[model samples]
Target: MPRQKNAFAHKKNTNENNQNKNSYQKKPEVIQEQPEPFEDLIPRIERLEAKFDEFDSSILEVRKRMEQYAKEREEEKRQEELERVEAEKAEKAAEEAAEEARIAAEKAAEKEANKESQKENEGSKENQAPEKNSKDSNKNKNSNNSAKPFNNSNKNNKNKKRYK
Candidate 1:
């Protein structure tokens, strides 16, 4: 029994020590130093790096195209702005022209009304001249003629005798 107990105690202690050893042991990162110098490796590195340079150049070209597209869009916007201004100017000019035409028409209408009023005044003067002359001649003729008596009383006496 004592021998078995010592063996079992030895086994437990060995298992505990193994667990502690496993817990204490950290994994080391591997870093390999190349024998070649940076200068000696440049040509080979350049060969691989040329491929990345080509991809970078393609990306730069895409960026340049995008810039050009943005420039064209800005130019289109500028052209639209200019056109809008021109259209507004033309609209204003057209409205001004219409207003001018209306003013001219009003002036012409006023001139015609004045002419018609003058013609009416002249015509009324001419008509009054003829009527005034005729009235003066009639008044002179009446003053020259003798006063005439009415024969209505003689006609009434004759009509009474005939009825009787």
Candidate 2:
């Protein structure tokens, strides 16, 4: 009987130890924190919003600068193109002036040549006039001499007939 009583007490002590081990193995409860109040988060949100606005302004400024640079480049190109066109026009004008000068020079040369030829022809005509006058004088003298000799012969024939 005492042995039975000691066995029962041992069994009760073992059951208590098993319960303690099981309790140690159980998962602990998770502690969840409450969300921050909206009022408390307002300042932080404002700060973030301010940072975004600053970033956007800087971006806009950079964009404006880029647009200004592009416009300046376009203006420079336009000015250069206009200058090139003006240069071409000036060159063409110069060429035209030169061509006109050349033509005028050629015309003057032709006029001078014509004047020289006309002078030469007049000179030749003057030289031929004296030769023609001299030839005509010689012909007149020969005809007069021949006519006088014929007249004398006829006179002699008439005198002989009268004497006969």
CA RMSD (A), model 2:
24.0
Candidate 1 lDDT, 110-158, residue by residue in tens:
9999999999999998887555558878888887895776769989999
Error of 1 at 74 (Å): 0.8
Who wins the TM-score comparison?
2
TM-score of 2: 0.49
> Which portions of model 2 show Cα errors greater than 4 Å?
1-49, 128-164
Model 2 global lDDT (CA atoms, 0 to 1): 0.90
Error of 2 at 116 (Å): 2.7
Estimate, for each residue in 8-100, the C-alpha lDDT of model 2 and write its tens digit: 665677878998989978889898886776978899999999999999999999999999999999999999999999999999999999999
Error of 1 at 34 (Å): 9.2
